[model samples]
Target: MTDTSERPRADLRRAPERYLSRPEEGIETRHAFSFSGHYDPKNTHFGALLACNEETLAAGAGFDEHRHRDTEILTWVVEGALAHRDSDGHAGVVRPGMVQHLSAGSGVSHTERNIGGAEGPVRFVQMWLQPDAFDAEPAYGLRRVDPAQGGLTLLASGMARDEDGEALRLRRSDAALWLVRAGAWQPLPELPSAPFRYAHLTAGSVGYRTVPGPQGGGRSMAPGDSVRITGAAFADPVAGEDGAELLLWEMHSPVSYG
Candidate 1:
């Protein structure tokens, strides 16, 4: 948890790539309907949380059926729309305002396709979380969000809530996600200051300030950027503005596994 009194700061990190495609399920792509992993094990934290910064999937171009086992995957639409089909006989469309979760416990097969029109491309985020337990049972869920409501909304949890966060309770390790839309310069409300903190900018830009570090001050980032904070600095404050749309993830340290 970052200290409430300390300001949030960050450092610049070279982005990463993972070859995830329709064929090998390559990690990163930049050509047509491009998909890129802003940060992943190949770049940052490997086998922990696969954060693929995806954007602009050409219309009609999508992934074919693929299998996944013992992985907790979440698909977040930052801009356009994406359609999903799974072996469980479930199918649905996801737009910019919503997130979809698929828990491939033992094993599950699924595919994603662009739902945007010919002229419009699909832009979104795909994350893979290593489960603490294998083959927990396959499940699917979704959560629509609006940062205008203020504070964090639990997108998926082990328990049910009365509102939007009520869905997506997994049987593996516990984790929660939140979204915030702030001006060019605003502070995030105090949080539990958990052991892990990750921020991804959906749109706009912001400056993250924190205690003096090896790089001097802090770091600044534009849209499609991400950051991971750890060590005792976990409690340091991080703020942004220029109307940045930020996605935050708090996970257990050491990334527990069963």
Candidate 2:
């Protein structure tokens, strides 16, 4: 059972405020949270989630090797293919419907590029989460999920309470990631009740409302929009005419920078 002692709060985050970055000619990134050179102390993080970035790269464009440590990085491809290579000897081409997970436990360096000789551009949404413990060995994982499988799919989980082996594992035992692809005007699956929940619309549009009361009113969400819910349960969202693809994070704990 969820604790409802505190009043439920729902906050909508429009996509227009996402910090835009064009570090290179063919690479463009829109960050939902404060990122490099874009600092917003009040919007730093929600729960264990540190960064949510939507990136697009032109063919033959890529990011050079970069270092990361003690961060759980998850990437979901929306269009085209992305080539990934890391110092851990892991290499793969991630495409739509695939989830790529990189646990930079202690430290690791990697490079990401838009696969050449294929599509026009590669677009993906990447999220970063704070791990429960730090300084472990680095790891990597990849899983393919079928959007048409029906209902919400558990793409990854680190929650101790979850025993689903199908989900790609995470390093934090208090966080989980879910994905859903809904048809036009289809009702979405019930959202998991958690102390902190963050929902991002990756494709199409959706209409959502808070449960019990109308704190947020019946609102429509466009692609790239996100909502942060604290101590609240929301009514299931319904897809718009073009259908919708959504990613949700269920976080039981807040960020601990220990």
Among all candidates shown, the one with the greatest lDDT:
2
TM-score of 1: 0.76
Q: For this target, which candidate reaches the highest TM-score against the unseen true structure?
A: 2
Model 1, 8-115: lDDT tens per residue? 434344333223343333222421112242323324342245444454576677778989887777778876688899999878899877888888888889988777
TM-score of each: 0.76, 0.93
lDDT of 1: 0.60
- Global CA lDDT of candidate 2, please? 0.87
Q: Relative to the unseen true structure, what is the C-alpha lDDT of residue 28 in candidate 1, on a scale of 0 to 100? A: 28
Residues 1-258, model 2: lDDT tens digits: 122237665677788878999999999999998898989887888988999999999988999999999999999999999999999999999999999999999999999999968659999999999998789999999989865367688988997666656788899998999997788999887778888888999999988776555455687889899988887645657999999888999988888853
